[model samples]
Target chain A: MTCQELLDLLHDYVGNELVIESRTTVEVHISGCLQCGTLVHAYTHTVRVARALPKCNPLPAAFEARLRAMIEPELKDKPAE
Target chain B: MFDPPPEKLTPEIVFREYAPRIYNIARRMLGNDADAEDVTQDVLLQVVRKLDTFRGDSQIATWLHRVTVNAALAHRQKRANRQKHESAEADDDVLGSGGPVTPGKRWEVGPEESVLAAEQAAIIEKAIEQLPEPFRDVYVLADVEGLPNNEIGEMLGLSLAAVKSRLHRARLRMRDLLAPHFEGKVTS
Candidate 1:
């Protein structure tokens, strides 16, 4: 695979979404080309950092209380038999 | 994972268990706290009213995921339309330009910079907010929320190949957005 090809496929490659044959070709290319290898490393690092982002903040207590109040009547309705 | 029968799910239980997760997804998807809360309430209320329709065909979590995604997307669309009507100014620039990506010089994160995880996370979140809607949804589902591509396709009504393509483009854009920060060229 050329560097450009490797760059294009880097996302799937890092995510392990590429088919085995295509993955092997990109792997071989990265092992041989320093520039492509660095680029792949950078891409991998980017995904890792993005995935490691903080979990979403918890729902606010006030909002939760309001949501509960809004839905309480519906919750109390009898279900269809 | 097995879900309890639909009849067994109480609103209180659902709220206690799933509200935080749904809020998180909406918050990330919409990039605003108020909108996220609105989505959380909308999805939870819909779940309450429609609980009887949920057969045991899928896990409750999966069903909730679908509901949350749909509600968040609808909210985003309404907000966009409202913004358009409220201002005569064409806000085309608010959507990203997908500009040319130049790989920055300092591509690799060195050991000295390891402490910047929180800062990097903030930058990454901002970058994600700037991604176009199609790419943003796939990226957030696959990368941020760790949902599989097939599930994301189902959630977004996209084909598997389309999901992969959008995800690839999103990741590339994320890398480009982050390069300048890592290179110390852009300081927040």
Candidate 2:
């Protein structure tokens, strides 16, 4: 496979969406070409770094209070089920 | 974190159980607490409104996720309109359309051996922030949240093909952005 062709399929390869034949083609291409290999390494590494970053959490208590204040009235105003 | 059955679900119960998930989605997309709060509040209120006719659904988490994504994307569009010309060039300038890629730098370190240093995380966050809006949306949902491609497509109102295309380009952009900061394994 050409370098551009490998780049085209790189995302699917990483996502595990490629079929066995396509997967093998990508693996073979990456093995021989250091440049393409670098792209693959960097590509996967980028995803790993991003996934490792701590996600936002706890939902901020003060804001949760404000949200509850808004929604509570709506629920209260509704006739009891 | 279990709660009442769907038929018995209350807005309070939802807030207690799922507010953090809703707020987390918004916080990641909007990139700031202020906007995140605004969208989260709106989604929560909307859920309460829908809960009036609340027939039990087996997958509240999936449904809630769809709601959160739509609200966040709408908020982003409004913000973009208000602050027109924030991005100087087109998205194409930032995202290559599967063009020939020349490998310049090799960030060859294996991730499994590496620890997540806070500084590296901060740099990655900044790179995410710099991505064009469309790419950023797909990247955040697919990579950051680890949602399946089909679900991300549904949430973003994109076709599966479009989702794949944008996501791939987004990763390339991210890889380029971060390569400078990471030392190659062979920097011996």
Best by TM-score: 2
Tell me what fraction of the real C-alpha contacts between chains A and B each candidate also makes.
0.49, 0.70
DockQ of 2: 0.56
lDDT tens per residue, model 1, B9-89: 666667776778888888878888899999998888887777766534457777778888999988988887888743322
- What is the clash count of model 2? 0
Candidate 1 residue pairs in backbone clash? none
Off by over 4 Å in 2: A54-56, A74-81, B1-12, B52-56, B86-94, B102-110, B113-117, B185-188
What does candidate 2's lDDT look like per residue over B1-188, in tens digits?
Answer: 11334566776677776777778767777788888888888888877777755557756667777888889878877887888956422264467686687576677456584457777777888888887878888888888877888998888778999888998998988887888887465632
Off by over 4 Å in 1: A54-56, A78-81, B1-8, B52-58, B85-101, B105-117, B183-188
RMSD of each: 5.4, 3.8
What TM-score does candidate 1 get on C-alpha atoms? 0.77
Worst 10 residues of 1 chain B by lDDT: B86-95
